[model samples]
Target: MKFFLWVALVVFFSGCNNSEKENTEINGDIVYDMYKPSEMSILMNEMYDYNLKIKQEILEGKTPVNFPTNFLNIYTAELSEFKSRNETFQAYSSLFVENQKEICNTDAHSDISERYNNAINLCISCHKTECTGPIPKIKKLLIN
Candidate 1:
């Protein structure tokens, strides 16, 4: 009788494990539903990384020379479901691009540090109205 009870318990545990495996598999393949960021989200992350590099270069006393042409995609990249490309967003984005250009196209009188800081400020200001989540991270991009 004890042997039979042990066998029953083993079978129950085995079945439970198999059921869990089945739940995670589909047609013999394990599939995961990963969160895919929107086009605008991806672009924004790239922009942040690019700006961080620019900030480092500026701190090192080097002016950034390459303007990421892809930055212009902000005008066309698809935003998250909750965000819209409204007039305010458009205006801020335009200003951000202009500031970025100033950082790359250094003039004899242009202060690269100030231009970089202005670009970072535009990012902060835009986020304040649209997506407040990234404001803190964006603030770190400032030269000072």
Candidate 2:
């Protein structure tokens, strides 16, 4: 009788453990389910941080000379699942790259501050049409 009771208890506990595992699998693990940013989102964030640093450099009377080559990836980076590339996005991205090059080119005729602000403005303009969520944050990148 004692042996049978012990085996039943063990079987009951083992069944409960199996049910718990099923529940976890069905509900998803919070740690692994966290939001993963798309490639474009990640690149845009890096660009924002890089631009913020450039802004500080300009404020301190220093010219930003380094152009992150990764900025070019904007043309190829993967956007969020719901977003798609369009003509307007391509146009704004091209203008952005042009303005960015001007900012980094020491020999360029344009004023550094104007070029920097234009690049930032391009970001705002593009976001206005596509993803307006970042407009307020991108606005902060403006020099003035």
The RMSD of every model to the true structure, in order and in angstroms, is 13.0, 14.1
Looking at model 2, the pairs that clash are none
**What is the Å distance of residue 56 in model 2 from its true position?**
0.5
| Model 1 lDDT per residue over 1-144, tens place | 864554444434332111222224579854432335668878888999999987888888888788999999989998645456899989999999998888888563768888888888999888887767567678888887
Regions of model 1 farther than 4 Å from truth: 1-34
Model 2, C-alpha of 18: deviation from truth (Å): 38
How do all models score by TM-score? 0.74, 0.74
Q: Please list the C-alpha lDDT of all candidates, in the order they appear.
A: 0.75, 0.75
Best by TM-score: 2
lDDT of 2: 0.75
